[model samples]
Target: MLTRWRWFIAVAAACALPSAAQACSCERPSGDLHTQLRTARENAVAIYRARVTAVDPAAFDGKAAVEVLEVFKGPVKPGERLDLPSGGRGACTIAFKAGKEYLMYAQGKDATSVSLCSRTHSVTPGTESELAWLRTGKLPPLPVALQREAVSCEPCDIDLVGGRLIVAPDESPSSWLWPPQAAEAMKEGRPFFTRAHVDSEHSLIVGMSFDGKPFELTQTHEYAAPSACTRRIHLRWCKRLDVTTPAGSPHPVFKCIEPGESSLQCDESKGRESSWRPPESIPADACLWRTSDTALCTLEPRMRLLPAGARASPVLKCRPQDLDRRDRNHFCQVETKPGPTDKAP
Candidate 1:
């Protein structure tokens, strides 16, 4: 009787497992690459190589999946090759260069680039454009560690997918203005900047000594993504109210404000002002994980957390056992090196 009961329990537990294949939806957990593709295909995601037969901005509502006909374009000339991401149902069309390969994703409400797999092989010129591409090169192993570097006591998450590295979500605010050094500079009646002396938004706050020379920094903060975990951020430094230079330009002399980037000019003609604002919803001098604020994570169907320091730190905040497991049934192994596709000729 005991044996019979044991057998019954085993059978019930086995049946509880979810299907190996499922659609890419919110309910689904972020999964391995094979699973992502399977579900994406079901959602009508496909790759294509066609000419610019026509265009419809409103097709997928703002997320049009354009089609570039094979007729012609610069590098990707007629009969050559090209790539595009699509909804596969013809509901939307994303734009691609006259003739080139592009990886597309189903960006959410706003317009954003879909996550493309750098590890997957490049799509053939004529395949569907919306289809996700995979990276073909070798990849490092899953992070072996995670750690905390910030003082607020907030921790960062990191993730490894199909051998790709990712940082976790960021919810910190810039309200922690005036790190230690910035505070001291103010008290000394010296000319000091709020951030690190690196840039005006310098992670290091800077202050002037009695002789108007540079001295001690109150704090050091690395600029990162604001909210999403994909976009990298840009930083700047300033010696005066409106005059700011790139992180590493001559500043001690401070004769004239020389803006390095053409896009960023101290154009007194445009009115001298430098209260830096993020291109998107980001704050100055903070870390960001995502590439574009309007962009979405396309590599996986669901979101995954990338713990801080998992790439190299000795400690990890997220428990190791807490790390989940997926079936080996799909996707190639995370490779630090690769074996040939076929045995020796």
Candidate 2:
């Protein structure tokens, strides 16, 4: 009876075991090569092309010494030697071999590691597209169906599709307001405005000039991302506002205004400007219109602006996930007309 009980217990224990152990799984990177590269660059602490100099043989304790050949992103310089983790004895870790060059997307507390789950891979024919981008910063061309076409409009030429305004990098005066590198890219005709997600109800307005009397252009300022805590004393939050400058010009078009404190003061009267009045709505046909108290507007009656609810197009059905996953404030999906072969009988 005891022997029979022991046999039964062993059988029960064996039955309790899982049919198969779970293996490592990784979520595939979304979007095209351009998007993948952008995502990797934003997430990884350091990115570079490097050749492995040495590697640890121990499967559990994998490590590699690599000589940096090129610094694509981050503070690491070329010719710098770095010790990075070789994806160990698991399916998720990268297998780093000595003498092999790799485009590594390194991420960790110190940015000294690689994983098979990342875009990191050996430099080969398979990785030529990535290498080309790293070397010359050229992006892969869009599909023929999704290619952007120029749309002529007043003030600036834009691509208005599905009610979203696609501004050319060169046409944006704000692009010239950026640092020298961005200004140079604008000059080179490389795309600066990759993506935007403007609301269908709203219109994007850029570059307006008065025909008659010369009116003083308002001196506008662009602010940097505000710090969590601006100051240590009152913990007053503040943002750094930089004066807008013209293309290739060092001098600011407007006088630099002193940075102001946040409206967290005890006196409410001081926070509100008494001279400020509610903005009056201007006619749609006028050279300019008041969309809001703080937004710029332009006249585009020829485009025949559609109502918000009627803005949906059958050709362009963008999913919520696609819109949510995008890393931009404004986004516009391309519309594709049905091909001759796609038509039903």
Best by lDDT: 2
- Model 2 residue runs over 4 Å out of place are 1-22, 142-345
Model 2, residue 343: distance off in Å is 23
Candidate 2 lDDT by residue in tens digits, 83-193:
877633333455588999988887766557676556576787646656676778885332221111111111111222111212333443332122334334334544332
Give TM-scores for every candidate, taking all chains together and pairing residue i with residue i. 0.25, 0.35
**lDDT by candidate, in order shown:** 0.24, 0.37
> Cα deviation of 268 in candidate 2 (Å)?
81
* C-alpha lDDT of candidate 1 relative to the true structure: 0.24
Which residue pairs show collisions in model 2?
Answer: 87-93, 87-94, 196-330, 196-331, 197-330, 197-331
Error of 2 at 54 (Å): 1.3
